[model samples]
Target chain A: MNIEEMTSMERVLATLCHEEPDRVPFFLLLTTQGADVFNVSIKEYFSKPEMVAEAQIKMQQKYGHDCYYPFYYASLELEAWGSESVFYPDAPPNAGRPVIKEFEDILSLETPDVFESPGLQKVLKTTEIMKKHSGEDIPIISVVMSPFSLASMQMGFENYLDLIYDDLDRFKELMRINESFCVQWANAQIEAGATAICYFDPVSSSTIIPPELYRKTGFRVAKRTISNINGPTATHMASGRCLPIVDDIAETGTAVICTSVLEDLSEIKTACKGKLSVLGNLNGIEMRHWSPQQTEDKVKEAISKAAEGGGYILSDNHGEIPYTVPQEVLTDISRSVKKWGQYQG
Target chain B: MEFEDTLLSLNRVAAKNIISSEFTGDNAFEVINEIISPTLERIGELWAHGEIALSQEYMASRICEELVETILPADAPSRKNMPVIGITTLRDEHMLGKRILSSFLKANGFNLFDYGDMGPESIVQKVKDDGIEVLMVSTLMLNLAHEVKKLRSSFDNEKIDTKIIVGGAPFLFDRNLWKEVGADSMAVDATESVEKIHEVLGDAR
Candidate 1:
């Protein structure tokens, strides 16, 4: 199968399940650049449905990337919980300051309804538009927060850690609620015709939390949620140290694992052992920060090492950072993927 | 109490806020001044016993900086009579402490200018442009302390009468190196920073 001949469904499922694809399918955390390149600001994109749809279309047509991500994860969802968030026309929301002043506040916290909150509702709405526009054309993977990451946003990471041991019951209650919202969000996307769901679990990475705590908290809810979902679910471990807990994460029943720059691809492929497809370990920050040639070299190196055992989706080690990863680097990365990522039977 | 408990207490103190009854942004530092310094000393004790993770200590330091943002006032009456102070980290770009010290001085009525992540020449330029009377440089990494010596030389050459205050994880770990950086004052935590700055600058009043 080649790019034009294969349907979006075939391309996604083939690559995610560790099988040969017509060609390598490319994806990105295209929220920031998609907005920039397409001329739709984040607030406008989120608040208005038509703007988001137009922007998604423009990013694909203009930039020629394979997939579209409705980027509402990091600060937006947390803002719905009472933290002050500053929004710029071009950039996604940034955490203004922590809202929960004391540990007691965590006990009283309530998870905002996904359908009700403006920020989250924007994501759902964007997914609806993308699903409609893509219309079985290309894969649309909607991103959402994992339980641990949501908790970190509610309170700062330190207070969140204390809650795990200091108040396990309340912690469990919060996770259950957040997980419920996540399932609802993912299911809504599936209904909207989304092919896959990407769960970005940055704060919960093993680098931040010990693997035991990660298993107890982040992995538990994640596994349950991924299992409940119908479409293929990809979990992003936003730190390199998560390699140790690969087995634990794989047990969550996710179809794919996208990791940060820290994990060496050689080690992760051996460890994953065909249990789950591995998507990344691209150096987004380095590539964004380094020269185009350097970017090409790193992408080629990453693709060479990771693309061997079938299930590999090439993207940055992380998502695109704002004002970083110059246009040339993005082009170089795309070129390298085409040059080196050919399937050898 | 356990060592972890003591560290948490310090974090709480450093991170405390006296959210004013009135809407105006000005806040009194009297409450934090009473508790934060002592709390930090106990945290230093906890770290000595290896009770807190290195990350936790770094976080505590960061939280102290965050707490300072709330404590400080945004609007200033004047910099004409007030002592002008500068704060930054060199080589290592950890803005947490620099932000904290900047906010702290702002709260206590200093004309504080932030020359963010600068080498010696840039720091000298900022000092000159801001008419800086006091300079504070921080190094989060141990190896970056050498930048402070370069900063001192630049200041002397520029004929600037600015008091250089050096502090960070590396300098705090070694007293001689802390002094060797040629700073007039230094402190390990945000609370101690208050006393250290006062001793070197002789009452910003």
Candidate 2:
């Protein structure tokens, strides 16, 4: 179907199936950029999911992109675990001192059910409200963070690194709880009517943790989280170090892999081929602030190289589009993709 | 408890024995440069090859830092009417580099206030509170534009004249970025830091 005929959901589903739906799909991460969508304070945006959804929907309606992600802050998980974190205007909440102060606290740790937990329930409620507002038109992603990333939140990033060597068996127990939480949370969102699960493991980037250690300690949990999810899934792995082990993550049955600009898009295309649909590598970090003409040129560059066939989605790859970037400058990316990312078939 | 045996076995006990007894004055600096630097570099190579994990690397780095501390001459800090330097790694940046850099500064006869792990604001406040002359910031990640920019702005607003020196992996990402972020000068390694500070401060003088 052509762009005019297919609804947002149809276009995205078609692309995920490796079929061209008249134009390339635009699925952007609207982080602090949502501030402009509402023109309200950042506090309101974080406090109310309705505001967050409204900002996302406005962008969706404006850009006519193929997907929508209900906004989530990485700090919400930390809050649920009984840690105090301070939130910046645009960034996610910062993990203060570790919540797991003692080994006994870790032993008493239990994976809170998503439906019952307050923090996750708030997110689930937000997704439900967002899905209702969008009328289930596009692929609304429930952003599920990786277990390892959540584990870092509980004990602080530096402390978790030390705990791995300080107490290996105890650390494995922590990993087990974290994985259980990831699966429960993602599955709950799927049940809450999210069309797909977007599994993001920002920490698993081999730069922070060696690939062998990542795979041995927590890769299985990552695999279980992705494999157990009921619907289509996508993953965004950050850092240049993550490039070496992208295929290992790709093997975990994620349908789509979103790459940062640090890796060669052509290399990733070669690596995933038929198995994984690819998104991002638009130099979104720097390009989001460029002029519309510049944004179009970068989009064209990505298209010519990575969009030879179907199965490629246009994305910026960052967690949240910075608020400083103009909305028009970003929409210009999809506008350029439609112009350049068309298929002959 | 010999240096050769410690180098082979990675034993801190043997290395500490040599650092404690047969080291003084100029000979102390030479032995550490020849012995400690090579051992740490080898460990760093193992880390680069993924032969060791981050925790193991941290422990190894701690051993080196302790060795440097134990070997310092009793009269080193008291002898200096030197510029007071404050050093810290940016919040979340690795501490191994900071430990090494501070050792180099201490070795060069500077009075340093080592503020272990601090965010941009805390370090800036420490600079103001401690009457710090030179501020050293180390960041491992390539993106520290926010931290560096905020620190520069804070120093300016507070009317503080602290000279900023930056090091670590990110500063090396772009040659001119350190200056762009308002650093007075930049250093690539521990030893270069000592020389760079003296040169920059001497020029200011």
Each candidate's DockQ score against the native complex? Answer: 0.05, 0.22
Local accuracy of candidate 2 as per-residue lDDT tens digits, B24-128: 655655666667665555655564554544444455555666676666553555435667888877674345567656655654445789887787777877888
Off by more than 4 A, model 1 = A1-4, A38-42, B1-205
> TM-score of model 2 relative to the true fold?
0.80
Provide the interface RMSD of candidate 1 in angstroms, 1 decimal place: 9.7
| Chain B TM-score list for all models | 0.67, 0.67
TM-score of chain A, model number 2? 0.91
Instruction: State TM-scores per candidate.
Output: 0.66, 0.80
lDDT of 1 by residue, A42-70 (tens): 55555665566667777666545578777
lDDT of each: 0.65, 0.69
Q: Count the backbone clashes (under 3 Å) in each candidate.
A: 2, 0
Regions more than 4 Å wrong, model 2: A2-4, A102-104, B1-28, B35-63, B66-85, B88-125, B128-131, B137-150, B157-159, B165-205
lDDT of 2 at A130: 73
